[model samples]
Target: MKLLLVEDDRSVATAVSAILTQHGFEVVHARTGGAALQALLSNGVDSFDVILLDVGLPDHDGYEVCGKIRRRTETPVIMVTARSDVRSRIHGLNRGADDYVVKPYNTGELIARIHAVSRRNVPPSGGEVRHESELQFGGVRIELTARRVSVAGTAVHLTRKEFDLLALLAQRPGIVFRREQIISEVWESRWDGAERTLEVHVASLRSKLRASALIEVVRGVGYRLRAPSA
Candidate 1:
């Protein structure tokens, strides 16, 4: 797979690039955020499978770069940073990163994370219905195929995770999805801190949907979607 390595530190980039190359990844090393963005934009649609973005970029913050990348493509981004704090992790995820890894990360673990995020982004295969590509319940409308949501006929913008959480719940309205199930489905991993991240995404979805009555909290169990009354 082709991968973009965005890091200003030459020694670190060289080491990581070597590891990735040994594993058969075609690594494109970019020393600055602008260079990375240029590489991404200049390449064809099938260019890069994943991006390893360092938070300490010389020209731009990783968070800003992540947002810009999201605006341009749905390619998976894994933020590589030394910021191990929960707030920083959440912030990176909120900014559209598929995953976050601290500096001094294990090469094996990093490779696994890269594969996990890429797998999650792949479109489902076979005859399964792409559930609710366009769904309308009461005044809320969801277009999963387009990744768009609207409430009371007004468009509502949501982060990537927020939309995924809502779409999962919307698939089976009124069924209480367990917290663990939600996390496994949405985040695609069983990270210890995933529960907290799930909570944050749920809260963000609720706020963006602006239809509190549509999402019901079942206390300690989990959350469920409430369809509009007929």
Candidate 2:
């Protein structure tokens, strides 16, 4: 797969590019946000499978660049930066990043994230049985194909992770999904720190849906979707 690696630091870029190259990925290194944007624009939107964007860019903020890229294409973006704060992570996701990885990260973890995001973006193969593309429970409507959600005919915007979490629960209403399981399926990682991130995403979903009672917490276990009629 072809990947765009956006970082201003030459040494870091070289190391990451070499590692990704060793893993059989064709890496395109961009040392500035302007250059990265130009590369994408000139090469066409579908040129790259995934993009590893640095938050600290010389020409522009990584978040800003990510927003621009999202506007142009649906390619998955993984934010790579030194900012490990919760606020930073949340902000990056809200701005359209598919994943966030902190600096000094394990090479295995980074590769895993790349594969996870890539897999999620790809369509399913074979003629396997598929779930309904659209799911409706109470006033909530989830359009799986369009990746959209609505409440009482009003559209509700959600971050990628927030939508994934809600859609997973919506698929099997009333089924209690363990925290670890949810994190593993949604974030594609079992990192201990992801537990807190999952909780934050849940809280955000509840707030955005404006139906806190829609999702019930199963204390000490996990969470389940509760139909409004129930």
Candidate 3:
């Protein structure tokens, strides 16, 4: 797999790149945010399979870089930073990163996350779909083809993962979706680390939609969508 390593710390970049190379990943090292963006612009968005971006950069903040990247392409990005707080993690997600990794990360876990996000980048086959073009629950409308969501005619902005999670549950209302199933399908991972991320997205969705009753928690298992009464 080809990867773009966006890190200002040369030592960390060298060590990480070596490890990734040892694991068969072709690494393109970029020391600054502008350099990373230049690489992307010149090499094309599809050139890199994954981007490991450090939050600290000489030219731009990783969050800004992530936003810029999102505006250009749907390429997967994993924020690698020393900011270990929950707020930072959520902020990274809100800015359009596919995943977040703290500094001093476990190599195996990071690699797993890398593979997981890459897997999610692949569009799902139509075989397992609910075959619905759009799903509606009262004022909420989910457009699967357009990947758009709106509430009562006002457009509701959603990150990619948030939309995926909502689409999965909305497709089959009243059916309970287990946490593991949701994570595996939505994040394309069986990693335990993603459970917290899933919860964050759910909470964000509830707050954004302001329709608490639309998604009901099943206590121990998972979440179920409550279709509106006719």
Candidate 4:
């Protein structure tokens, strides 16, 4: 797979590029945000499978670069940063990065994240299945294909995880799900079975689904998607 690596630091860029190349990914290194934008507009955007972006660039921040790129393509983006704060991660995610990796991160872990995001963005291979275009509960309607939500026809933005969790719950309302089950359903099989991660995702879902109070915490049992009428 071809990958674009955008970082202003020369040493880091070279090191990461070499590592990715060793892993069999064709790497295009961009040292500045402007140059990165130019590369994408020229050829990288259409050709690359993934973009590894640095949050703090000499010319422009990664957030701006990510936003600009997203306007043009839905290519997967993974933000690379030295910052570890929750706010920074949230900011990167909100700006449209598919995933965020702290700098000084393990290369193997980074590669795993890249693969996971790439897999999620790809269209599923093979065959027909029962698919629903819209799911409705408690006056809320979620459009699965568009990844959108409407409460009484008013729009709302849900983070990717929140949307996935909500969609899973909406598919089987009143059926309780263990955290592990939900995690396995939403995340790919390669992900570590981390219950804390599931908890965080569920919390985010609850926050976004605030108008309906549709998600019910079941104490030690797990959680249930309860409609407002329930």
Give the local distance difference test score of model 3. Answer: 0.82
What TM-score do all the candidates reach, one by one? 0.54, 0.55, 0.54, 0.54
lDDT by residue (tens digit), candidate 4, 141-171:
8899999998778888888878888887676
* TM match of model 3 to true structure: 0.54
Clashing pairs in 1: none
Q: Which is the better candidate, 1 or 3, if ranked by lDDT? A: 3
Summarize candidate 3's per-residue lDDT along 149-203 as a digit string, tens digits. Answer: 9999899999999999998887656545667778887998884878789889999
lDDT of 2 by residue, 1-230 (tens): 67899999999999999877655567899999899999898877777878999999988999999999999888899999999999999999999999999988988678768866865774223211126898877888889999999999999999998999998777656545667667888888885887789789889999988889998887765777878897
Best by lDDT: 2
Q: Mark the 10 consecutive residues where model 2 has the least summed lDDT.
A: 122-131
TM-score of 2: 0.55
lDDT of each: 0.79, 0.83, 0.82, 0.76
- Judging by TM-score, tell me the better candidate of 2 and 4: 2
Worst 10 residues of 1 by lDDT: 123-132
Ranking by lDDT: 2, 3, 1, 4
Q: Which ten residues in a row have the lowest lDDT in candidate 4?
A: 122-131
